[model samples]
Target: MTFSLLARCPETGRFGMVISSSSPAVAARCAHARAGVGVAASQNITDPALGPALLDALARGRSAPEAMAEVTAIAPHIQYRQLLCVDAAGRTAHWSGERILGTWGVAEGDGAVAGGNLLAHDGVPAAMVAGFAAARGDLGDRLVAALRAGRDAGGEAGPVHSAGLLMVDAASWPVASLRCDWLDQGCPIEAVARAWDVYAPQMAAYVQRAMDPREAPSYGVPGDE
Candidate 1:
């Protein structure tokens, strides 16, 4: 019912996730990240708490595989959940429980991992990792490219209604968080991509507004003009 990727930009030290699922508000439950810590995705009977728990271990100096093992070991229903993690060092780890849905698989690249359950084909996850590795651009563009490749390879067993992208940089807050929840009309992945297209250019400007509103560009919002 879900497909997700956790990636790190080795050059910039940025961490991000791109995910889509048949469930509404999937990102709210499945995706987690911290600026200099790591990223985690908990899905398929997701235990949202597991995400933060894994990050906690990573922050405590554990590697991604060790953190994932510790957290999932303590989870009550681990057999029903799928988990993935990538630490600040770009070390990756993942688990697809025995109870995971049909045609599930995992793929890993230089600084990324892709995984999915209830997929139309087993090759989907591999295609995603390959696409991300081959894409030429910033992390955001590469993420969208991976997502599009997954969709092209045949997504979930059914149409996915929600999608999201989350990116954390050097700030305490996320530099980008985009979502398309319960999309009954358009493709949720495409919706998120469109939102990213509009947001990426203004991402730095937004941070500037928070740090120094005087120098931030005005966009004619209310009193700004």
Candidate 2:
């Protein structure tokens, strides 16, 4: 059982996703994004390849709906997977197979989409979309807010053990990839949010370091000084 949101920031051309699940390492399997391409989630019976396949289609100039159609047409065992996508153009698409788990729901908003299976209520996804629409700051902030809203609306049918946040901008790689693979005691979403709070202020510095180390900020460690 899992819930996820995919979004694009029109102001900055960034794509992001936040996902949580009752399983371990949920993001490693379900979360997918590519800079200048799109973001995707492939869950419910979990076809990890589908995430990449959807992005590949988008990178090749397919719209979100077209990519979903193409992948579902060729993907094996398609009846068991739930898929979501948002292209660079901010167009969104999703597919919930006939065999998707219980109480599944999906909602789309301006430049964003949310979905979940085995959910506490059908409104969870809609709550996430609304939260994203209302929040401010960077794409990561809005994504985490959406995730919190889903939790408040009653998240998965059971306790979620893993959560993740992924984001990409103009870089060839993700600018943010934070994960709580497994949390035995507390909520993984909260864990991920705390991690984001710590990471967000430093995110730009890390990008600068990658792009042009000489102009990057100090590492604040003794050796760097």
> What is every candidate's alpha-carbon RMSD to the true fold?
1.0, 0.6
lDDT: worst 10-residue window of model 2:
216-225
Clashing pairs in 1: none
Determine which window of 10 residues in candidate 1 has minimal summed lDDT: 216-225
TM-score of 1: 0.97
178: Cα error in model 2, Å: 0.5
Per-residue alpha-carbon lDDT of candidate 2 for residues 1-225, written as tens digits (9 for 90 to 100) = 999999999999999999999999999999999999999999999999999999999999999999999999999999999999999999999999999999999999998999999999989999999999999998999999999999999999999999999999999999999999999999999999999999999999999999999999998788877
Off by over 4 Å in 2: none
The Cα local distance difference test for each model comes to: 0.92, 0.97
> How far does residue 18 in candidate 2 sit from its true spot (Å)?
0.3
Decoy 2 TM-score against native: 0.99
